[model samples]
Target: MTHRLALLLLLIWSTPLRAAQEDPASAALAAMHQLEAATVALEEAESARDRVRAYTNTIRAYETGLAAMREGLRRAATREVELTRRLSAQEGELAQLLGVLLTIETAPTPVLMLHPTGALGSARSGMMLADVTPELQARAAAMRQNLEEVQTLRLLQKNAVRTLNDAMASMQQARAGLSMAIADRTGLPSRFTEDPVRTAILIASTETLAGFASGLSEIASGDIAGMMASISDQKGSIDLPVQGAVLHGAGKADAAGIARDGILVATRPRALVTAPTAATIRYLGPLLDLGNVVILEPQPDTLFVLSGLAEVFGKVGEVVPAGTPIGLMGGEAPQIGAFLSLSGEGNGPERSETLYIEVREGDSPVDPETWFRTDKDG
Candidate 1:
């Protein structure tokens, strides 16, 4: 009996130890370290072009790592709770088993055998002991499993904290590199001057998006003929001016109940905004309630209005090549707090710094999603 009990204890402890060897958290931790290396590469990039590419790679890596870490933490927390409950139950079972053993050791063997029920009572008691022993052994095995789970969960929690800190630091460095890249480009000449009187009239007379677009169409200066691609041909192939997720697509009602004529993209704070195609800037500055705006006319009949900019680069009527840096988004880095917010995690609010993109064909609002390459379209 003693040898069997010892063997059960050994099996209980060794089984969980072997099972605990398979861990997914180590892979997540390794990815985070790779992201840290990418961040270092971004910081060391020499040219504006290199910096841009490196920054994008680093951001992507950090986002991926952050997501992995968050998932790891969540799974660990759940496992910890489950193991804690199992441990409590096993402890209770152990205490009961110990009490039974103590009672058996204290009571006289003759008393147990010569009870009132005599031989029948002794037979029943022996049967009960035979059943309880296996139950006690099972409970002990469960306790060992719970202990291993608890240890694994602790390691996961620690890794999550370390990864989060590293991600934050990488984000800060990437933000700084983006700022420096923006500052390096200078001397973009304007081809047309802003018509202040006309702009004022348009702002005061227009109330709806369609009206505002029409009003701008009348005052917009610059002949885009032979300078850009045909807008109709580029449908579904054109890239967005900024890299981000589409928060509200065209014809969708925003939180204010206003149906947008364009798409709103939620991006990191101070993210570099670029020209999606070869277009001449027709209008640059604030208009109505929209923040600083940049109007680009890729063709005579097509116009793209980008609003909610914190700063405007290039001058009015300046012709820019495709992917030219135009401006930066408003606010600080990690705009909406953390990458977890991108996945709708936590209670933190969504990013308020949105890039509003409006595409118009001859004064009529067209759905930007139909033309631009959004994630949903892909």
Candidate 2:
């Protein structure tokens, strides 16, 4: 029993080892290494006394690796089981052939047949049957061929399964290691607390993305600019039926700002959406971080993006004079559009209605600060 147990273990271990030599197994191993690396990085990040953002990112990486490992493992297991069943069936057929051979050798022949063209067609018919008949030989050959096919399939399956299993195990190990590292680094549960600020930030960010998307839709609909001008002229603001902060700093985005007062105000000439139609009522809902965004086409060529307001005034195609009340910041703590300029490269050119608000005088980039004056309260 001990020997059997030992052999079984050896077999199991060697099976994976042999499988690792196969192409699929090798690929699986490679993937497993990637998973391990990701997991390790996650752990290291967690361990290094870093910010909550860093730790959260590490955790996310571990999860992604874990997911990939699981998917690979599932595929491997399915293939392995399918191949194993086929192998078993082939083995059974071989065994039946052996049984037939044994019966032919043990049983006696009841009668002999003669051919018209020969004195004796066959002398050792029973003997020939016992050893191997043409039919039985063909069957045996077919069985052998099937066995070979099954074995080859089994080999491939084994390799694939081993590769996947190893990768999964490695990933799991890495994840555990990273978790340990994070725990050691953060002394964690201490890190766990009510993050109301983060929650609010996320909610605000999501709203912003949504608003941007909506504005893009309006742009695509070709009504954004017109609507903004109309909103600026008539209503004090175009409410998205939503309430949130507009954290505008100009250039490309990297962070968000919170409002402490009732609303954040855009004191200067904020870039508004450019459009052709007059008044497009594309409503933005409540709780959008974009606060309020309205598009306005000052001229046929120039477009503006205005945010941080509740209601805006201006009409589409209506040549409004400078210093119109496009809208006012309506958040807890409203802010101003401090500066605006061209978007630096790497933030690909705006493809949607989302405009990268830039101020230019002909070919030269102009600072929006120089053009739009700040309101007294702004």
Model 2 lDDT tens row, 1-378:
133333332332233344445543343444454444544454454344542333333333433333333333444444445555766777777688888877766755543334344544455554565465778878887766655654554454445444445444443454344344434442321111223444344445554433333333322322323222222242223332111122232343433453221122222122222222232322222335445555444433333444444444432223433332233333221111110011111121211112122233332334333333322210
| Candidate 2: worst-modelled 10 consecutive residues by lDDT | 334-343
Please give the clash total of every predicted structure, in order: 0, 52
Give the deviation of candidate 1 from the true structure as CA RMSD: 12.0
How would you encode candidate 1's per-residue C-alpha lDDT over 1-378 as one tens digit per residue?
133333332332233233334353453444445455545554544333445444544554454444444444444565667778777766766777767767866888777676478788888987887788677666656666678768876775655556567667766676566566555645555456666777778878878656776665456455323553566788888988875778897889998998878988886566667788888887778877898888888877788899999977766667777777677788865532354344234322334578999998886888887788896310
Deviating ranges (above 4 Å) for candidate 2:
1-32, 47-57, 96-378
Model 1 clash pairs are none
lDDT of each: 0.65, 0.37
Residue-level lDDT for 300 in candidate 2: 32
